[model samples]
Target: MDIGSEYLKIVIKRFKEAKVTAEKAIEQLTESELFWAPNEESNSVAIIVKHMSGNMVSRWTDFLITDGEKPFRNRDDEFMGDIQTKEQMMELWEIGWNTFLNGLKSIEEEQLLKTITIRNEPHSVMQAIERQMYHYSYHIGQIIYVAKFLKSSDWKTLTIPRKK
Candidate 1:
């Protein structure tokens, strides 16, 4: 079976757009700013990316053969802001992005129809894509929002809508 290139293309495009947003947000941040959590219970952007990496790697690596939520995912520690440096956070993002993109590039048409189990719940491959897209975009929005708050007057607008 063949997963049509068109569908994969759309999914990849959305994912890339989110990556662009994340990069822009990070670029606006200083090293000290990355560690600033709004409150004691909140996470910084660094913490979010670390969690994203954990989610992506577990959910995508050997994706079809393994459970989406891996035994290795430390869901509780994600809020710890464990990635204390810019280098480490970016490296985690790279790892997650590479793993996810590679998996998307290889998805088979058969897999698109096959029911895949995520945390014991079954979903078609397309649904999984939708789920992850929403998940990532939600977090991307958080990154952008926090960056803007930190920037205040210095922030540049990122997704200007084109009036048609």
Candidate 2:
């Protein structure tokens, strides 16, 4: 059985689907909406994007050679929602995802069993990818929920339309 190729195919497909889902939510939001949080402690869409993008860059850059958590990443600052414009947010989003996907593409079949670290905890390469996929999807769900709330009546359907 070709476990490695099969795993890569599934991971890539899931990642692509996740990106499309997030983009659908993003399409309904304005710049201000991206930064809107429910309250002082909650995260905004912009903040979620920032955090995920930061994670992507850190985890994927030289993925096999380094810890998934990069030393330069300021995990706290990502929640600050410092991005002032949708353009900047999207650009950063693309930058991080591009880095992640490119890194994923670089992985070989043999690399899946190799050990990696996140915050000094050991994980197989596949385990690390699965971890990020779940983490990013969790944040993307938050982004979609917030965008849907912000759009209110104008919210276009990202999934199946409501029952007639």
lDDT of each: 0.85, 0.90
Question: Candidate 1, 46: how far from true, in Å?
Answer: 0.5
lDDT tens per residue, model 2, 140-164: 8998899889989999988888994
Best by lDDT: 2
TM-score of each: 0.92, 0.95
Candidate 2's TM-score reads 0.95
lDDT of 1 by residue, 1-164 (tens): 33466788888988988898889888999988888888987878898888888888988988787779889887887777667689999999999999998988889766787788789898888898889999988888888889989999888778784472
